[model samples]
Target: MNDVTSGPDTPPLTKALKETAHRLGADLVSVAPADRWSEPPSFDTSTVHVYPHSGYTPSELMPSTHSVVVVAVRHLDGVIDSTTTDTKTTAIQGNFGYVLLNRKLNDITFGLAHWLEEQGYRSVPLGSAGQSRYNHRADDDPDILSVGYGVFSLKRAAVLAGLGRKAKNGVVASPELGVRMRLGALLTVARLESGPLLEGDPCPPDCTICMKACPTRAISLGGRVSHLRCFTDVGRRGVRYEEIKAKFKAQYPVDLPDVDYVDKEYWGNEGTGNRMCKIACVAFCPLGKRRLPDVMRRVKEFEQQRPKVELLSFPPSHEFALDAVGEGNSAAEPSGSG
Candidate 1:
C-alpha cells in the first residue's frame, strides 16, 4: 500500500501489496494495469449498463486508477459439492453460504482499500455482491444479450490480473480452486507493475462437464452463456417467494402485522435450512477431483442423518489439476527484500 509512483521501486511495492492481500485472507491476489479495461470485453457489453451510471471506465471510476487489484477466496472444500434436499443443508449450500462468503470477501477488499488509503493512495473497493442488476435486451429482438446493469466485470478483471481463466460455464476458473471461489476487486491510483495473465485454459477443450451439467442448458460448448436461462432457473425460488409473500399480505392484512413473512425455501430457517440455488456446473467440474473424496465423505456423513439431494453425475478427472497450467505458479510472490 505504499504511495510509490511508477519507478524501479514499484515492483517491490507491488509484491508487498500482494503479500498483504494474502495476509488479509485472500486465497489468491494479482494486479492488473488499468489499461486492461481499454480492450473490448470478452462478453458482449453493447447492451449492458454499469450501475450508478453507464459508460463508467477505469479512468472514470478512480480518475487516477493506474492499477486494479483482484482477489479470490476459495469456497470451503465440501460446501458447494454437498447437495441435500434437507432444507437446512440446502440453504447452507445454496442461499446463505454464498451470501456470507461474499460478505467476507467484500470486507477483505474494503480492508485492502483502507490500507491503500492509509498509505496516501486512494482506492475504490468493489464488493463481491450486488454487482448484477438485469440482463440487457435489444429493443427489436426482445432477447437478453448481456448484463443490463453492473459496475465492472470481476471475472474479466480476475483474468487480466492473472488470477485465473474463464471456463465454458462463464465462471472464472482458478488454477488452484477451479470455479469454487468468489472474486472481489479494488481500483487504486497507485502505479503498480501489472501481472501477466495465467497461461493455458483451466477448462479442457474436450471437457464439457459444465455444459452437460447445466439444468437449463445455459452454458454452451463454445463458451457462450444464456444469461436469461441461467438467471431464470437459478432465481426460481426468489420469484416464488415474492409471489407467496404478496398472497399472504393480501389474505392476512392485520394478522401478525409486525412479523415479517419468511420463505424457508429461499432463505432457510434459522440457518438450519438455508438453501441458495443449485450450482451443478460448478460442482461437477473435474478440475477439483483431488477434493472429491473429502467432499463425498462429508456428504455421506450428512446424508446418514438426513437425505441429501442427488447430483446429476460426478465425472472422473480428465486431467490432473496441475496439468491445467504451467509448472511455475503465476501468482505474485512476496519480495524477499521488501
Candidate 2:
C-alpha cells in the first residue's frame, strides 16, 4: 500500500476514514488502539478465544495493526418486530432482512478496508466469520455452545473502540442504537487517533427486562449469559427451518418456492429464522428506546396482542411466532390456527 497523505502524521486521513465510513452506511464508527486487546477483558476472559488459532490477540491479526476501525449498523426495530408470526414462513421473511443487514455491514467494512489500502496503509477487514471457521472448537470443549471462538469478538471490539458499552443483556449497547446494532471491524496499520472506552453502564441496575424476556432464561440478573441456552434456542430455529423447507420441497416438487431456507450462520452473520420472532429480550430494553418511539410502541402492541404459549407446549420443530401486525400495518387480526 502506498501512502496518499502528505506525511507520516496523518490524523486528517484518519478523520477522512471515519467520515467515509459514515457516508458508506455505518451508523456508528470509532477507532481503537490495537494495544487495547492486550488488556484483559472487563468481563471474564476465559470464555473468549481469537482466530486463526486460540491464544491470539487482535494485534496479531496484523503485525503492524496500529489501529482497529469498528463500525456498527442499527437493526431497525420494525424490521425485527414484524416477524413475530406463527406462520411457518415468518422466520424466513423476518430473518432474511437481518441477514441482508449483516451483508451490508460487511460490505461497508470491506469498503473501508479498500479505502485504507488506497491511502498507502495495509488494511484487513474482518467480518462475521464463516460458519465452518466460526464453529471450529479447540481441544477444550466437547459440548456445543461453550463460548465458540471467532476471528474476533466484534461486541468486545466495539466496546473497546468506544462505540458502546457492554450491557447486562450481554450485548454492546450504544447510545444511539442501544442493543439493536451489528458490529464489524477492520484492522489497519494507520496510526489513527483512538477512541476511549465509553464510561458508565447504559443498562439500568434495577431493570431485568432482557433476563425476564428471554424464553429460555439465557440471560441472568448478574449479567451472566448462558451461550449454550441462547445458541440452542436460536439454532433450533434453523433446524426447524430446514425441516419446513424439506416438507415444502416434497409437497410442491414442481413449483419453485418463494423463499429458500438459509442455514443459520452461528457467527451471527445470517440470523436464524427465529431472529425477529424472539427479539423481546432486545426490544424491551429501555436503553435507546426513546429514539424509536414507534418501534417501542409497536413492540408493546405486539406483546399485548400476541397470545402467549407455553414454551414446552410450543413445538420444538417450529419457530415461535408472536401475533402482531406486519410491517407498516397498525393493526392485524390474530391467526385462528396455531
Candidate 3:
C-alpha cells in the first residue's frame, strides 16, 4: 500500500479532524501514514537530505502510530515583509520575527493532539521537534537528561503529508503561502486516510533565483542545504540564542541610553555574536503574494556584493535514527549541537 494516496474520498473521521484543525487555527492539515517515514516515495533523497531521517518513524514516538497529522500556519505579514534589519532581535534568529508564527502553529498541533486524545486515540503533539523521554539509570548515567529532546523532522513529515512542494530554496512552498509557513504535527493512533502529494512543483525549471540570492550560499540544487552555514550566518553557530538573550536582559539596566543599538561587546558582554540575513529565500521566491517585490530587488542587488562561501552539513544525522529505540535511544536523542 502507498504511504500517500490520491483517494477520491476522505474518511468521516479524517474530514472532521481537518475541520477541527482549521477551527483551531491551522491553515493547512493533512495526513501521512506512519510508515511513510520508513520508505520515502521513489526513495527521494531530497526529502531525506534537508528534513533528514535516519529512520525515525511516528511509531517511535507513538508505538501504535497509524497516521501523522501535519499542520501548518502561514507567517505573519509583519514578519514576511519586514526590512532586512528590523530591530528587536528578529525573533527567528538574529533579526527575524519567527516566534509569533511558531506559537500559532504549535497551538494548532497541541489542539489537534488533545482533540484526538479525547476521541480515545493516543496522540503526541509534535510542536517544533517534539520530545520523547529516554530510559536512563542514574547509577550508570546520572548525567543523561530525558527532557528537551527533539528529532521528528517536521518538514519531512509535511512533505509526506502533502502540504506543499519542497522548493529550490529548501523550504516547502504551499500553493497559497509559498515558503511563508511554519509546520507542526500530531502523531496519532487513529487511522486517518492520507492525502496525495501536492500536484505540481511551484519552482520553475532552470530557475536558480533563490540559490543566487543566498548571501551565505547555503542552498544548492535539489534542496540540499547546509544547516551549519545557515545557522552560522545568524551567529547561531556556537552560542545558545536564548542564553545570550537572557544574559542581555540580566545585565542591561533599562535606564541606559540607546539600549537597542548597543554593540555586541556591550549588550552581549559575553561575546554573543549575532548577525542577520535578509530572508532572500522567501522574499525572492517567485511564488505567492508573500514575496515582497521590493525586498526581492534589494536581495538580488545584495547578492552580487556579498561574499560567497559554501558550507557543509553538520553533526551526522544517523545517530538519531530509531533503530536504537528499544536499545535505549530516544527517537529524539539529542539536538545537533549548533
Candidate 4:
C-alpha cells in the first residue's frame, strides 16, 4: 500500500518476503508492476473480447491501482524422460512440478496480499480470476501471450521469472531442471517494487536445432510460433487431451472445466490424428539438446504422413513461403519456383 520503499530501517522486509516466498515452495520468484500486465501491451481487442484493440487498460479491467507478484515452477526429475513406459504419466510428472509450485505460491501470495491489505493496499493473484470478488478474467490468448511483465512471450515470461531461457527448441530451459518448467503469475493490489528484467540474452544466435526438428515447419526463423498448426498436431497424435485423460484419468482427467468447448475443438484434430507437425517441431529443437523418443517416431509412421520438407528456413520474417510456390492476387507474374 505504501508506494514509498521501506526505509533503511526496514530494508529487510523485501528480503524477508523473498525468503518467505521460497520457503512457501516457489522455485523462482520475481516482483512485477501490475500495470505491466495490463491489456494494451498484450491483447488485440479486434480478436479477443476481454481487452481493447490497443490493449486492455487497467482502468477498464480494474479501476483500483496496485502491484503484481510473478512466480515460476520448475519441472521434476522423471518428468521429461521420454523412455518412461507411461507417456501420459511422464507428461503429468513433468508438468505437475509447476502445478504444485503454483499451488504453493498461491498460498503465499494470498498471505502477502492479506498483509498488504492490512497495510491498506489492495492485492490479487496473477491468475486470480474467479477466486474472489475482485477477480478478473484469466484470459491469456495466443496472439497476446505477454499479458505479464517479461520478455518475448509466455516462454520468455517463464525465463524472466527466473525459470530459464529460450531453448534451441523454443521451450524455456531452466539451469537447474533444464527445459522442465511451467510458468504462472499473481496480480496483487499491493505496491511492491518490481524486479529488473534480466540483462544479457540467454538465447543462442548460432543454434537452430529446434527448427530442424519440426515436422510442419511451423516455427519461423524469428522464433514466432504458430498455435493452430501446433495444436492440430498435438490433438491428432493423442498427446494433448486424449493422452492426458487416458493415462491420468484417475488423477487428472483431461476434462478442462473452463475450456471444454475449445478443448474439444482442439482435440478433434480436424478429423485427423496425425500430429507430425508438433512432434517434429518440438522433438527436434536443440533447446536442452534432447532426442525424440522412439514412440514419437513410430507414431509418425503409423499415421502415414510424410513431411515434404527435410531442411528449410523461413524466408525473411515478412515474406510468405506460399508466395514463392503459388499464384496470388498480386499482379506480378508467377515465378518459376511457384
Candidate 5:
C-alpha cells in the first residue's frame, strides 16, 4: 500500500482526491471503508450511552459505498480558549472557523462528491449547504439524499478516517487542531486510500481538565456525556466559569486541582453574544494548545505532576501527516492517522 501502485493498490484517483482536499483548505483528509459501518457498533452501554443521532449504515444509504472520505479543518484559534467564560462571541460573530468554516467544509465535500460523480463514481456530500442542486422538485428535501447522510456518526467517521482519536470531550480531537475543528464527509463508491488510527491517548494521564471544566458537569469520568446538558444548557443559557469553579471548589479534594484559564480571542470583537458554549473542554486541554514543541513541554510537566499515567506526544504531525496516510501495506493512504 505504501508503494503507491495507483491501480488496484494505492489508486491514483485516491491520491489526486486527497491533494484536491488539501488544495481546498482541508488540514486533514482520510477514508473509511463501507464495511466498517456495517459491523455492529461496539461500546459499553453502562459507561458510554451515546447513540449518535441516526443508526443507518453506509451500505444502507449507498449500496455501492466503497469508501467514505472524511475531512477536517481548524477553527480560528482562541475559540477553545474561551471555555472559561460564559459567552463565546469570538466564534459566532462571523469568524472564519464558525458558521463560515462549516459552510466551507460543506463546499469542500460537495465539490469532492461532484468530482467523484464526474469520475463515474456515485458520491453524496454530507452537510447543510444548498439542497436545490440535488433536488429535482423545489419542495423536495435532500435530507437523505444530498444532506449529511450515509454515515452512522461524523465523529466516528473522523476517527475511522484516521484524523485523530476521539477525546473525552466527545469531539474528534486532532493532534494538530485539537477539538476546535469542523468536519465534513462524502460517501462515495470510489475506494480511496485510507489512514491508520492515531495511537495513544490524546489527553495526558491524570489530566481530566475537560471533564472537570465542564460548566454543566455533562461529561462523566467514564466518558459518558450528556449531550442534552451540553447543547441545551450551553446553547440556551451559556456557560459561566464561576459556576463551574464554585462547584469544583465545593467538591474540593486534598489539593485543589490546577485549572488553567486561557484568554478568549475576540476576532469578531468582544461581547458579541453569549449564545454558545465557551467550549471549556477545548479550552483547558493541553493538546493543540500550541505548536508541537510547546505541547511537548506541557506533556513533560504533566508527567511530573501525575506519574501514574505516562504522557507522550501526539503523532502524525505536519511533517509526517502526508506520509502517515497510505502507510500500511494495504493502500497508499493511511488506514487511520498515526
Candidate 6:
C-alpha cells in the first residue's frame, strides 16, 4: 500500500509501467509520497530570505491536494556551450535553451498527469517562475497563487522529493545531469514509491572548476554566491567585455555623467557582462568523469587557467557544502555590488 511490493504483478506493474513512461520520453522520473511534499520550505519566510531563488508565492492548491510526481529533462550541454564562442549565438541559445528544455519538462509533466488522470486520479503540473511575467523584483513577495496547483519548482521539488540535495550554487545536480537538468512536477493523490537522494557531493573536494572559471568571482569559497555581482558581470561583458563596450558606445551617444550612466557606459563600451564564468565553471565540473581523480584533474586544470583573483575558488571539505577559498578563516571582500 505504501511502498511498491515486488509481487509477480508488481514487477510487471511497476517496472514495466515506469519504463514505458521513460520510453515516452521521461528522462528522470520518480513517484514521491504526497506527504514528503507537505510544507515545502519555500513557504518559510526565513528560508526564502536565505535562498532567494524560490518562487515568491506559496501554493495553496497542490500542497493540500495529493501525491507528488517529479520529472527531469536533460538540458543539452552542446547548445549551452555554443553560447561562449558566438555572442549572437550565446544570446540566441541561452534564451531558447532554457525555454525549450522547460517546455519539454512541462510536456513530460503533462504526460504523467494525464496518465495518472486516466487511472481515475486528479493531477496538476507545476508552474514555472521564469515563465510567469509577474515582477519578481521583490523576491520575498512571490506570486505563489499564479504558480498555482500541482506545479512545483524543479529546484525546491528535487530536494524535497529526495532526488538530490541543494548545492551552494543553488542548483540541483544528480548523478545523471549534474546541474544540467531542468525540473518539473506533477501533483496527484495516488500512492507511489520515491527514490532516495544520492549520497555525498557528486562533485569531488579537489574540484574547484566552477569557482575558478567564474569571471565575476560570484561563487564564494564557502558555497555562497553574490547574485547581483554575477548578474552585473553577465549584463555587462564578462564574455567579450572589451568588445561589447566598443559596440555599445558606437551605437548610442551618452550625455549623462552619473555613476549609473558611467557604469552603463563602461559596460556598453566593453563586452564585459556575459556569463562566461558560469559557462566555464559548469562546463568543466568532474560530474561527467569516469573517476573522482579525473574530476579533480579537471578542477586543477581550471585553477591553472584562472587569472589570480584576490580570492581563489577552493574546494569544500564536505561534499555537499562550499567553504570560502583561503588558508584559515580569512574572508575575501564580497565579489560585487549586490
Candidate topping TM-score:
2
lDDT at residue 169 of model 2 (Cα atoms): 73
Q: Point out where model 6 deviates above 4 Å.
A: 1-17, 38-59, 84-88, 127-151, 235-278, 288-338
Candidate 5 global TM-score: 0.60
Estimate, for each residue in 1-338, the C-alpha lDDT of model 2 and write its tens digit.
64223465667887899899999999889988777776454433333222112324567667778888989887765655555433334454345445766677779989999998887888888854323222323123323222344446677677767888778777778887788777788888887887766776676656655554555555655565644345445334333332433332232222113534223324445454444236666665667643444444444455444423233322322222322212322221122321
Best by lDDT: 2
Quote the positional error of residue 59 for candidate 2 in Å: 2.2
Which segments of model 1 are wrong by more than 4 Å? Answer: 1-4, 40-55, 84-89, 147-149, 234-277, 288-290, 293-338
Give the CA lDDT, 0 to 100, for residue 20 in model 1: 85
Worst 10 residues of 4 by lDDT: 129-138
| Per-model C-alpha RMSD | 11.6, 10.3, 14.2, 12.3, 16.2, 11.8
Candidates arranged by lDDT, highest first: 2, 3, 1, 5, 6, 4
Model 1 Cα lDDT, one tens digit per residue, 240-333: 3224223323322222225443222121112222323356566546564234543323332332443222222211111112223231111211
lDDT string for model 5 (1-338, tens) is: 12112467457888889988898878778897766554353433243232254434677667778888988877654444333333335444235545677677788898888877776778888752211111122113212211121224677677766777767666777878777677788888777787765655575555555554454545656454643244333424323432432332232221212523212211211112343435545544556644323222232233233222111221111011111222111221112221
How much lDDT does each candidate structure score? 0.57, 0.58, 0.58, 0.40, 0.52, 0.47
Q: Which ten residues in a row have the lowest lDDT in candidate 1?
A: 313-322
How far residue 144's Cα lies from its native spot in candidate 1, in Å, is 3.9
Sum up the clashes in candidate 4.
22
User: Could you tell which candidate, 2 or 3, scores higher by TM-score?
Assistant: 2
* Deviation (Å) of 2 in candidate 3: 24
| Cα distance off (Å), candidate 3, residue 277 | 1.0
lDDT of 6 by residue, 1-338 (tens): 22223345433434543674587576777655555444543234332222233432223544434446667766565554454342333444445456565566666667776775665556676623233222223223222212111122556566656565556454677666666666777766555555554445444554455665565565666555543334434445323322433343343333233423222221111222334443554444445312223223343444444443332221221112334443221121112221
